[model samples]
Target chain A: MADFNASDLTCLRGERLVFGGLSFAAKSGDAIMLRGRNGAGKSSLLRVMAGLLAPRSGALCWNGENIADDRAAHQSRLQYLGHQDAIKPVLSVRDNLRLWGQLRGVSQLDAVIDAALHALDIHHLARITGRYLSSGQKRRTALARILIGQSDLWLLDEPTVGLDRESCAELSQLIADFRATGGIVIYSTHIDLDVKNPNILDLDDFAIPMVEWLTEHADLNDDTNDSANMQHSVSPQEAVQ
Target chain B: MSGFMAVLQRDLRLALRQGADSVMVVAFFIVTTTLFPFGVGPEANILARIASGVIWVSALLAAMLSLERIFQADFEDGTLELLALSPVSMEMLVLGKVLAHWLTTGLPLIIAAPLMAVMLNMDQSGFVTLMIAMLLGTPALSLIGAIGAALILGARRGGVLVSLLVLPLYIPILIFGAGAVEAAQLGMSATEHLQIMGAILLLTLAATPFATAHAVRLAIE
Candidate 1:
């Protein structure tokens, strides 16, 4: 069983501190529901987990090995679904799915792709180009990608934004199946998800306070924004335990 | 290797399906090159003298026209983030993209340059040198331009921004490429100029993928 952990994660975006003092851990078959309002750093935390964004101060590890040390291995083991639906306008749905499978070095894609397409209920739209797909269809296509390749972890950012009710139900079913197969899913969504016994991570609890953000920005002008000073600025009492 | 090929093949297929993007780039090269004679007058001696510079400059601009789309389309639609997350190193995926760009934009420019050379009253002796020079030079344009393309991934008016960012860097290729034909026309060996262009191509080939990949990573962040 794989173990994923994040400790003392602090994220800075531009001149603003998005989040500070965040930590979480997951094991095989674990489902994590990241809860936060818009702009509460849900997406940033997800990106950090996917290794797409480096935290200002934190370490992400899988099975006790630092993910940063072996990025390719980390990347190979996870699938990330960002806010944008990555479908190419000119390519048909099947070709798009096949293209990603090929990218993952999945040589025998015919059966896997067909199964993924079926899982998302997009088998009928396989021949249609992405330009003609509705937002719901496009979201389904993007979600279907998570199943095309073998991955132990999934980092989905606002995955259900454009999905319809039926498609959302299909996604929940897919997530349940994925967890049953020893996969760990960490997803952020506003809608209720049906996954069992999910570890709920409330990002609001980790959000860097506005007053602290202002002080940090104020430090930028003083040229004293070094990590030493920044750490001191966060009162020991407020830091996450 | 399969990851690289996957990106390359997918990009090539997209280029083929769109079909017009490549055609428009070639057409822009042709149309832009054809205007030189009308602007400078059809004097054979002058046209012949200016053909190398004119063709190279037009090719540079034509190549620039297509640069923004190299990474911008993927960046916008979010394919770049996924590509970055894939097991393949960003450098390899970037190289695949640069090759696809060269095949679609640079290759067509090379093929169409000879026709423009003939129309500009270029010396017959310089024709082969011009084709050879472009063959050695255009890939470098795509390579260097990929850096600019990747840089301008989220910028406003990125097409214009790419030209401004990439044109200065393209000057070396422009000089050597045009100079090769000029040297050949003067009955001198164009090998030295060709070699310099080849070196520049190899340098960009080795370096730009990494640079572009880094820029792509920053844009994704």
Candidate 2:
């Protein structure tokens, strides 16, 4: 069982302190739900944990050592599925997944790709290029790579947006399978996911200081307090809860 | 090694599938080289005098035309994030992409340069030197341009910005590539010019991968 821990993490996004004093820990077979309104720093927090964004202050420990000591080793064990689907428009569905598997350094590819495509129910669309796939299909194609790669930690950001009901259930089962196999899963969503019980880490609690900082300066800006977690894409104002 | 080859193969496949980008690069090289004869004159001596310069300049522009897209497609589609997280180091990843760019963009320009030289009525003695200079010089263009492309990721006017950023660095290659041909025409060995271009190529091969990889990480952040 692998151990993953993040302690006293503060994300300094752009020029502002997006979130602060955040911490979460999980071992294999654990799933932590990142609950927060938009810019309450859910996505940014995921990026930081994914090693894409640098935390202003904190420690990310994997197994027993700090990730910074051996980032490639840490990254090799993780897969980050961000807001974008990461599909190549010109490549066939199979080629896209195949390339991803190759980049992950996975050998014996045929079995893995077949299993992944089957898990996402995209095996039938294997020959189609990305340009012709519908939005939902693209999402499924993107998710399929996760199965092929079999990363230890999956940092998914709102993965169910374009999935249909059946597809959503399929994804839930896939994640459930991943967890049952002792993989650690972390995700962000506005609505509930159909996983078994999950550990919830509300980013709002960590964002208290930035909200305070905003309010302190709201005296001059006036509008900063009105829409507290103002952000586009997911419209984070509702995340202040 | 497989990771590097994986990226190289994937990019080559994408280049083949899209087709238009590669075609446009070759087209620009041909069109730009031909326009020079019209701008100056059709006189054989004049064309020969300017052939090496025109071909080298056009090749640089052609390589730049596709430079911004080397990482742009991957960056836009979020594949760059995945690449960053891969077991491969960022430096290797950058080098892989640069080599891939050379195959799709620089290789095509190299194939077209000799023909363009003939079109410009370049002296027969200069042909070998012109090809040698371009073969050595174009990789450096792709490598150096990788840094500019990586820097301007997601910028609003990335095309123009890459030109401003990359053109100055490209001047040295242009000078040496044309100078090699000029030396050959004057019945002198172009060895020194070719040697310096090789130095620039080796330096960029060692250096730009690290710089471009750094810029890519920053852009992703």
Candidate 3:
């Protein structure tokens, strides 16, 4: 059984604080849904969990050990699906999925690949090159990539976008099956999904309010105690000017 | 190692499927080298004198032309993000991409350089040295160019920016690579120049993977 936790995570994107004092934890067989309006740090949080973006402050722990201490072990157990489908226009759907699996050092590749494609209902479109696939098909292809590897955690950012209702249902079923197998999932999306007993984290709650952000900006503008503030936040635009 | 091979195979497959990318690079190398003869007038001695320099420069530019493709497509398609998250280290992934790049872009340029050398009336003695030098030098071009490609990711005018960023770093390779052929033509041993080019290649090979991987992580961030 694996335990994943993020505590006091503060993330800065460019100069803006995407989120602060944000924390979440998930154990085996848990599904966490990240919900908030647009620009509410949902994707940033996902990226932070995936260890792609280093949070300015805080730590992510897997099985009570900080992930930063062993990035390779952390990476081995997680799969992250971002906004892009990662489909190469020149490769067929099947080849595209296999490339990811192979890169992850997945074994029994043929069986895993076929099963994933079938599960995603893209088996018929497997031979189709990425350039010819519709957005829905592309998203399905990307989803299928998550199934071929032995990942204990899945971090999906807007995994439901461009998916049809049927495809969404398929994804929900996949999530259910993954949970049943004791895998953990954390995902962000705008649409209603049929994930069972998801622990919802509204990013709006963790977002620094506009008033506080404005005051911080004002404080910076006033050059009051520059050293303390400069270490925490230096927006690229500010540095340029 | 399997991950590295997978990336290499996938990239080669993509290059083969696209069909036109390597061809365009080779054609650009050929056309650019051919123009030198026309511009300088077809005097054999003069053409011979400048042949090594022209071929090395053209090869450098051709390699740079394809540098953006090394990571641009992967970055845009989000493959890079997933790759960074995968079990394979980012450094291994960068190396895999650099190898595939050399195979598709560098190998072809090596094969084509001989034809251009002949056209430019290069001294017969310089031909083998030209091939050897490019074999040593082009991988460095691809390696150094990888850093540039990764740096310019998500930037505007990345193609132009990659050349500007990598071309200055390319000067040392150009000096050693062209110097090798010129030395061979002048009846001096080209080994010292070739050895230095090899050192550059090895240093770039060891260093660029980490640098390019770091740049790529930043680009993703």
Candidate 4:
């Protein structure tokens, strides 16, 4: 089964502390939602988890193996869909999806792309140039790429951003089905997602104090003193609450 | 390799769909070359003497005109990020783009330079040498321009910045390309200059991809 564990993950953007000393794990068949306000580093945390962004300090492992040590192997099983759609405006929807599937070494990409477009209700638009597609259609096209791939982990950043109400409902159901198939999904958004038994990580409550402390002592050396500072800053009540 | 072919195929498909883009690049080359004669007057000796330099400069500008789109469109639309995240190394990705650029712009210029040479009343030997030099040199132009293209991604006024960053690096190509034709005009074998251009092409084909890949990553970051 696929599982990801991030231990003591601390991320800093210049002097601003995004997240610090955070930990989380998601096993196969699990869906986790990352909730926070706009500048709360939810996207940053997702990037760090995907191994696309490096953390200031800590480790990220996939299936008990360090992602840093085996990046290619880890990346093979992971698919990250960021805020941008990543489609080539000059190419047709069919070409874009086929190219992505081919690059990822997936066989029968045509059938897979067809299925994905059908699922997204965009099969008729396959021959159209991506530049001509509506914003929501383009978003659905991008999402189709993720759906067609056989990745174990899906790191979706606002997967439902431009979807219509029916499309949004369809995607929510797709996420549920993916989890039911024993795939792991970790997504970040400002909107509340309707998922079954989601392990919600509310960045607002758990993140502010940690980020504030990290911002203050960002220059502290990686020694016992830093740990002492962390302990002194967070009392027992603050730790749990 | 399949990865290389995949990238090449994708780029070609995009270029074909945007037919006017490639056509405009070739038209720019011809128009720019035509402007020199009008500016310098219809003096055969002067035009013939400066023909090699004018043709080479026009070719360089044409190549530069197309370089920004080598990765900018892809990068802006997030396709570059997907390429970077793919199993294929960025170096290979750069190589694929360089080859595609050469096929689209550089090869056409080489084929069309002779027509421009005839129009300028260039000597037969000089025309042959000019075509050979362009064939050897334009690939190097495309390869080196990839690094510039990758670096200028997301920069303010990126089109102007791309030329500013790339023009200086193109000096060597211009020198060798023009030198070969001049050598031929002087009745000397242009083989040595052609060899030098080929050497630069080889070195760039080996190294520019890695540098371009790093620059692209920095741009994304």
Clash counts for the predictions, in order: 0, 2, 0, 0
Using all chains and alpha carbons, the TM-scores for the candidates as numbered come to 0.94, 0.93, 0.94, 0.91
Candidate 1: how large is its RMSD? 3.8
Clash pairs of candidate 3?
none
Alpha-carbon deviation at A87 in model 1, angstroms = 0.6
Q: In candidate 2, what are the lDDT values of residues B49-136, reduced to their tens digit?
A: 8888889899999998899778998899888988898888888878888898999888888888889988898888998998899899
lDDT of 2 by residue, A93-143 (tens): 999888778877788898899888898888899989999999999999888
RMSD per candidate (Å) reads 3.8, 5.5, 4.6, 4.2
How do all the candidates rank in terms of TM-score, highest first?
A: 1, 3, 2, 4
Residue range B1-221, candidate 4, lDDT tens digits: 56778898889888888878778888999999999999999889888999999999999999998999799888887788777777777788788888988898898888889999988878788987888899889999999999999998988998999899999999999999999999999999999999999999999888898899899877765
Q: Write the per-residue lDDT of candidate 1 for residues A97-195, one digit (tens) a residue.
A: 887898888868988989999999889998999999999899999999989888999998888998888888888899989899999999999888777
Against the native chain B, what TM-score does each candidate's chain B reach?
0.98, 0.98, 0.99, 0.98
Evaluated on CA atoms against the true complex, candidate 2 attains a DockQ of 0.78
Runs in model 3 lying further than 4 Å from the true structure? A210-241
Error of 1 at A157 (Å): 1.5
For all candidates in order, the CA lDDT equals 0.90, 0.87, 0.91, 0.85
**Candidate 2: misplaced stretches above 4 Å?**
A211-241
Ranking by lDDT: 3, 1, 2, 4
Q: What is candidate 3's lDDT per residue for A1-241, written digit by digit as tens? A: 9899989898888988888889989999999999888888999998989889999889999999999898899898988889999998888988998888887787889889999999998899988999999999999999998998898999999999999899999999999999999999999988899999999999989999644665565544555665446544655546789
User: How well does candidate 2 score on lDDT at residue A149?
Assistant: 66
C-alpha lDDT (0 to 100) for residue A178 of candidate 2: 93
Alpha-carbon error at A29 in model 4, in Å?
A: 1.0
